[model samples]
Target: MAIEYIEGDLIASGEEVVVHGCNTRGGFDTGFAGVVKKRHPAALDAYMEYHRNGGLVLGSVIWAYDGRLIGNALTQPTYGRAGKHISYAAVEACMQSIDDAARNGVPGTPFSGGFTRVSMPLIGADRGGGDWNEIERIVETTLKSVKTVVYVLPGHRPSADALSSRPRR
Candidate 1:
């Protein structure tokens, strides 16, 4: 199934897993990461502590909450716009992990039987300098079972058939 796109505020979707692509280097201090940091300080603390404890690894993920559910996919070695920082493999791996958590329940989250809806900004795109088409394909391929929503900022228009899950045209 293809990914569904929605133009709205991803940060305010506290009920959905606010997943975003970040580097293994740590610190949610720039771009969309910074927005996440400001909205969910506990996630930032968890990420900071996790980084300090040497949890740096591509394809890894860290889930944390502070009145908000945040999923940090360590899908890049670092962050910069000079070249592509996003790893296609890592993004897929991270999404697979999130798919597991969304299907079988995240170990520490308050809910059980996993999450029903998963939401995120374009994973591995934006500041990571990755291709959106590729990332969208990865998301569609990896997050098949659960309801998924890809949020974009306002002024961007979604497909007329955003509600459909058929393959991308």
Candidate 2:
């Protein structure tokens, strides 16, 4: 898979092929798109750049168990876990972002006039209190139905630490 993983602060990785993670809105000076739109010029530029480069901006929202939509996916970190459970609400939100990008004719999508590559983070599996496996399964299932590239960010744990931490690597 040409799909690559990146791990770092979203701003530091702003130029990433596709930066992925949580709390994107927090990075804004005044916080939130509405506030940034009115106050931060650079924030707007970064957002435009992200859109121009075909980034998938997953908004804040967490889904409930047995929910009908993925619009309420969680974006907070909780405990030792990465995120909350993958809910139908969360997946719907992601898919909607993709659809919006395609419709807007973003850079990466040559066929649909959208970016060819899309980068996103592990959603709904952190503080939102969702299951990792379920989230992975939901994302995988969604990806299987599409022809887009979705590169996920891996844990930022250092290589040496990861190797030493592994059971029998």
Candidate 3:
């Protein structure tokens, strides 16, 4: 019905499609996208290929699957010092695409498990530099047709031993 916020790893959330906001410039070198990139290099490769093909438009989506289905939303242009790189409109459009693909069917990317549940971190908030309230609103309206799981990381900071192994997005 509504979005469900749970504390855990978005990478291991196990939803049919894991949605996350990414830059349109095609660099997954840092932040949540970085973690996704590290976990699924194929996803970055897919995005790069898509980028070269001129599909990396703002407000567009790229479906990536390398053992896990990832809905890479082109919601921003670049990273680095920024006020708000995240485009709320782009986020909305991306979410709509994911909802449509899950509820209906995306031509080439056939989703398994009927695409019932989708998970994401607080996309565009921490790294993308977006307001959580607005991002939440956008997703709420766009993904009403499917189950949305918003994964919030626990409060405790990871120790040095666990730093190298933490999953961000």
lDDT for each candidate structure: 0.78, 0.37, 0.78
Give the 10-residue window scoring lowest on summed lDDT in candidate 3.
Answer: 156-165
Q: Which candidate is the best by TM-score?
A: 1
Candidate 3: list runs displaced more than 4 Å. 108-114, 156-169
lDDT of 1: 0.78
Q: Across residues 1-169, which tens digit of lDDT does each residue of candidate 1 receive?
A: 5556776788875445778888887657887889988888877887888889998678977888666578888888878767888999999999898888888887767745788788888777778888877888788889877788788877643332443444564
Global lDDT of model 2: 0.37
Clashes of each: 0, 28, 0
> Candidate 3 has which clashing residue pairs, if any?
none
Error of 3 at 118 (Å): 0.6
TM-score of each: 0.88, 0.40, 0.85
Can you write out model 3's per-residue Cα lDDT over 1-169, one digit (the tens) per residue? 5677776777866666787888988678887788988998878988999889987899888887877788888989776656788989889889988888787765555574348888888888877889877887788788877888877777623322243244432
Off by over 4 Å in 2: 1-4, 14-86, 96-112, 144-169
Which lDDT tens digits does candidate 2 get at residues 61-90? 321111111122223322223443234554
